[model samples]
Target: MINLSIEEVLKYERGEVCNEEDCKQMTLERSQSNIFMAVVLRENNKLIGHIYFNQTVPFEFLTWEIGYIFNQRYYGNGYATEASRRVLQYGFEELKAHRIIAMCNPENASSWRLLERLLMRKEGQPIWHNANQYAILADEWQRNNE
Candidate 1:
């Protein structure tokens, strides 16, 4: 398991109350959720970003939902794409997940491109949330891999 400092958690929380106590509680809760994995990215020993995957039951579909955050300085560096690729490989090969899904704001064109490059299908029209939805099936991923 990866470890994160209280200070680092505070920074990532983005102004939320991420005190030591809260961090401990959150860490314990996260530990209990065996279906998720969180990874921290470091450069020059400095924490720069983090990503996570969680298994969810979305409607009739059982899927893995991915979410990530990066330090502002790390944007446009392709780290998101590489990290997401690694996660997808793990999800398919190791976790044996049948589906994976990701979503982003319609205005976030970069995310759309990354998803396309990974060969994930667009599915239906955007679902209203804080952002639009995109998804890929196990068959779609397998065909692309072949």
Candidate 2:
């Protein structure tokens, strides 16, 4: 059990108490993989979120999944949408992915809307008690971008 103010908790979660050595080692390892990347503010270089695009099951298919999480304080500013759109573009153009998919709880309107804003097609409706799935094919992405 710990007693901490909301501000204190946010600072801790932001890595105020993190070990420099551990963070450096982690940066080295994570930097080796293009699958994950940090989203930083351009003005001050503050870490705001992370976005990843990685191969899925049966890797030969060249399918990938894109996902992201941003600081609550930074939502609705188009950061997530911009970062995620870039990630999806990388998967299609650089990774040569045949398909890129994303899933979000339909109840999360902002999240799903962001996905749609990326030009991903909704694969299914919200009727089922499951997360809404969306996807974009490489050709479709290219066509849209072109």
Candidate 3:
């Protein structure tokens, strides 16, 4: 199988690969949010992939949404999981978010499974993007980690 690389992911994010400028702009706009937080890794100080969180639309008061992307070369190495967990902890413990949610394309099995492994409950199909939503509450998170 062909692997997706971080360079590819970044190109997609920057609207260079996918021809979807909206996605690149959305990421840029969301990055400006005060509540945004990220978990990143590097080799010899060179940046790698990142898992990040930001306030979800219309629920920006307390709930948040998360997103992540890693180099396809890092697939199956647990790097995404490890970094995501740290960001989740930061979202709840540091940011005091009451809830955190994530959504992924339905066809992406690995993406959904990662949310499940993080103890997020499947909330069924979302209204847009043909993606599935998963969420976890702060109390639920605390209980699981405790």
Candidate 4:
């Protein structure tokens, strides 16, 4: 999952976006503490999107935040959905997550709809960015998947 670009690397490093490089050394350095995955098309081997999850809380609680973005040209083909499902599976099965959460603007119908498709329920309607928070528990995921 060391496919974070140089711009994302430098932006995260120096607090700004600069370049997009595929250099492995820089990728290894950046990928150690965080998880960032680039989604690519298997038929053509082209990068179309990315999804990531991380702990951003004082207490771990085995909870993680998942987010994703895909090229507009690649939309409507289920690429984002497939990538998100894989990440959610890994979080629940491998990482033993108690819960996984996602956030998106309420205005973005497609985004929240995708979250709904993943069986996440909307829990919060924050005014900040008019964001909607969605979450799914590990038990819920397991039952649904099974």
lDDT of 3 at 102: 89
Task: Give per-model TM-scores.
Answer: 0.67, 0.75, 0.73, 0.77
lDDT of 1 by residue, 1-146 (tens): 12243343334233354555765676578657864444445645554555668788663565798766555556688887888888888877787888998866666676678888788867656555546667877777778788
Model 3 agreement with the true structure over 28-70: per-residue lDDT tens digits: 6645765443334455543345555777767666888888877
Model 3's alpha-carbon lDDT is 0.71
Question: How big is the positional error of residue 75 in model 2, measured in Å on the Cα after superposition?
Answer: 0.9
Span of ten consecutive residues with least summed lDDT in model 2: 1-10
List candidate 2 stretches off by more than 4 Å. Answer: 1-34, 125-129
- lDDT scores in order: 0.67, 0.74, 0.71, 0.77
Per-residue CA lDDT of model 2 for 61-126, tens digit only, reads 999998776667787899998888888877788778999998777667777888888888899876
> Clashing residue pairs, candidate 1?
none
lDDT minimum window of 10 residues, candidate 3: 1-10
lDDT of 1: 0.67
> Taking the tens digit of each residue's C-alpha lDDT, what string does model 4 give over 74-145?
779998898999999999999999999998777778888999999999998887566789999999999999
Candidate 2 global CA lDDT score: 0.74
